[model samples]
Target: MTDESESMETTNDESQKPESQGRMQILDHALSQARKKIISSAKLQLFQKHLRPIHKKNPEVLKRMHMQLTKQLDCHISEEVMLMFAEEQMEKILDDLDGVIASQKDNKEEAWRPSGDPQQDSRVYNISVKVKQKAQLQHVLSQLEQQNTLLRDHVALRQKKLLGTKRTVDSGISKWREINEAATSIPADELVEFVQKYGKIHRHHTMIPWDDDIDVLVNGSQKEAMSRALESLPEYTLYRPPLVQWKFFSKNITRSKRPFAWPYIDIFFFGENETHIWDKANRYTQLYMFRKADVFPLQNKPYQGSLQPVPCNSPRVLSRTYDPTLCTTSSYTHKEERSKDPGSRKTVKCESLYRKFPFVFRETRDHYVMETVKVGDCILYQTKAALPCWTESP
Candidate 1:
């Protein structure tokens, strides 16, 4: 049963969270800028600050430190690649990766360099780890495996369609159909159910609605909450898009090169203690954490009563219009997350993903207009559903 006291406490708790997030956001930005300036100011300063004589004796600690540094560098590389996006994104990616890696290597305290880490030595290992947290890394690894397997399996089928050997040679292009088919099979409903039953699902949205992008926040209160609520499934992996941001993708559909196949669940977590979710190959939805208070304004006023759960329109959707021209440049998305992989007869799953800013569940002329965003990819939309907004048309 819902405890009256617990419910009151929860209300109080939720009320305070957003304010906490705001204070923390300022502090976080300040600290991040300080770190950036410090890193850029002088390599010696950073090395001296993070390094120590005791560190030499504790090689494990030093190696760990290096691993962490390299990982941060890789995150920057991920951002650079995305900012460049699609055309020659690779050259910029390599250049940025090399630059970040090099700076990290130089700034890397000589005492803690990975030359001492026995478990990992390869560049690929370092590059991959540096880029993703532990969960995301594993997901990417699984995706890589899936990508390779699809390539080999489809090699024969793709050869005839290719005029030259090129398209057939590039597994990304050849295996997309297979990849989409695989992803599309698991219906959104199934995915939502899976998350509810077995996944760690942290859900929230932004306070102030802006015309820019949609925001869906995801943070479970404590360590156990994060672990039990967010981490049960190895089926999905966390990932970084082209350069900077992180997202989670189902391992089942990671092989597709189709932009649509870049399945991602956009999650934003609140206020510090970000350590639990930031490990390499490990994926998290948001880079910054906010407390409940920081995001309270974004919370939908419990329409009708408190028994209903949070509504599903996206933040931007609740506050904005559907201008296709503006939508193209809006830098927001509401696309299908993981396209169905070919050869699968299973139903494609979709959840009612939306934030519903100013969420008033009312009746429209004929249909109830609702704002929606896809689960993994914060893809947003505005459409009236079969449900009437009110008993009578307005």
Candidate 2:
């Protein structure tokens, strides 16, 4: 080859190599920043999620506020944290009050090596817990009785309230033991089976500040098809009749770092193309355009969840049309029309969630029921007691 040609080829390879290296470095840096931000932010997010009421009145109390949160119903905690706390509080905080004992009949102990102090038997890193009859331990228990009388009363009171629905969950959040039971109630094997048998079930944590239940996701095309198919299944003869329609919705933001996947189970049913079913279901759920999809799936791999319905045989399945061609709006004539101005255009974009679907298709219903779990699986699939269709949404 000629010397000039060789030089030219060498230059091209060098240039391309640097550019490729630079792009990779840039992507890596961006990913690192995002991970740091999300993991750090998750700590604070967890705190906010457990504690209800926007602001706590006193700044001074905020120091010990988290510790003393159980008795004072003035504060609140979610089920996830309550479960963690319930396991620890009795031996530490609720000392002398012989009442805070867990009556679980099962003796299944989790076996793991200890990392910290080797006083009794169990230890995990810096936290070491042991069961023994020490000398001053009795005195410390006495101090608990005197200093924290509210501990015993609070324990009994919450146990009594465990019979109700919302209260059971709320009370569980109060004692720290709630989430453990919640987690244990549903077995992991059962959950896996349900997800495998049904479509995907995403337990997503959305942008909503206060933590709710898992974000159940499902696909669009298959969702419609499955609604019709769920009818033939004989197991679905639990309470309600067969279903005909179902709806789906993504949250208001996309590409946003989510809070806690470890803490809660998000039963998501994803779809490939963005479906306007959530918008139409607003008529049924009474929700405004509160949530929106931030990102689109690569192809038709949208997440479809079991919450979408199966056997096409539930009491609640409505109708929906697919319009995946463009980001255009199909016939949507609202009674509250506005004037012809730039503001109207902006408002439409905002109301329709900025992300428009090609066709409005039609409205649908989401009447879901939990079916049986996998063999030896203890997973509890949540059924919507009632649909939150935003019909009166302004």
Candidate 3:
């Protein structure tokens, strides 16, 4: 009986051995899978950390890739796909990390090679830095130029809309009537002459079919009185331009038709020197040195259905200042011809230079004078009293 019992126990122990071995095998497999998963996760984390800096520094590269993919595939790709692609590429690159490091070190050593002369090396480095900075500045300038071009295009569109509309003849007639009424407010004694009288209402021969702005010549002595009288009128508002010229516009008018189609007047003052009639607002530039008999005398001329004071010798003065044939003709286009003419080239150049370097010139009632002098640059006007006012370059 003791031998049979021992045999049963031995058999039971042998049967339990296979079950325990199977459990041990299952535990070993689970641990192997967990180790592999942890290693993959750590590798992914390392890839992401390395790629983050590259993405931040080279955003345009990603944008270009996205655009190319969108165009090539003819489908919109989400941000996730691009990121996944980048991660895969980064992982491949990191697989050869030792090679990459070796190449980078070689490049860095070559770039930072020191010459025998410290000064020469320093100069080379400075020049390289300056070149890089210049490249960056040029890129910024290109962006600014694009923005400026867009702004200019927008402004041109607005101008086209403003200029395309035409004012009616009736509206023009009404505007002229309003202008005449406003002119009547100025006292007769303060008025000197009417200039640029080209409308149908003037007694003098009309040149242009359409009436433009009215230009009035007032006595230089009585300019203050004229200003006061014009200001007192409720119909007009006074605007002063540079050079002390007065421009009167209708109070109710908008800026869209300003100076050209609006009911307005430009007042120019003239003073007589020893021999010449000088424009007070134009740095006392000589207008004319007329003979005693040819001097302009104030005379009443019909203008806008009202009598206004004007120069009696307007024909003579106009002939002297403008081409008689062109001025008298009803339909003449001289602007293009004048611009192309060689005789006006010098004047155009001087005007352009003056506009470009306004700071270099000083304006006075007597004359326009240059405030600076240099060896190569020409001083157009020089006076004994004028002093050099050269500003240092910043």
Give lDDT tens digits, candidate 3, residues 253-289: 6665344224556678767655445457665345533
TM-score of 2: 0.17
Model 1 ranges off by over 4 Å: 1-215, 220-224, 239-245, 255-261, 272-394
TM-score of 3: 0.35
Per-residue lDDT of candidate 2, residues 270-381 (tens digit) = 3232332232232323331112221111111112221222212111221122122212222321111223344333213222431221111123344522232221233323
Over 62-98, each residue of candidate 1 has an lDDT whose tens digit, in order, gives 6566556645874685565445555655545656665
Model 3 has an lDDT value of 0.50
- Taking all chains together, each candidate's TM-score versus the true structure is 0.21, 0.17, 0.35
User: Once superposed on the true structure, which residue ranges of model 2 sit more than 4 Å away at CA?
Assistant: 1-150, 158-220, 228-394
Ten-residue stretch with the least lDDT total in model 1? 192-201
What lDDT does candidate 2 reach at residue 60? Answer: 39
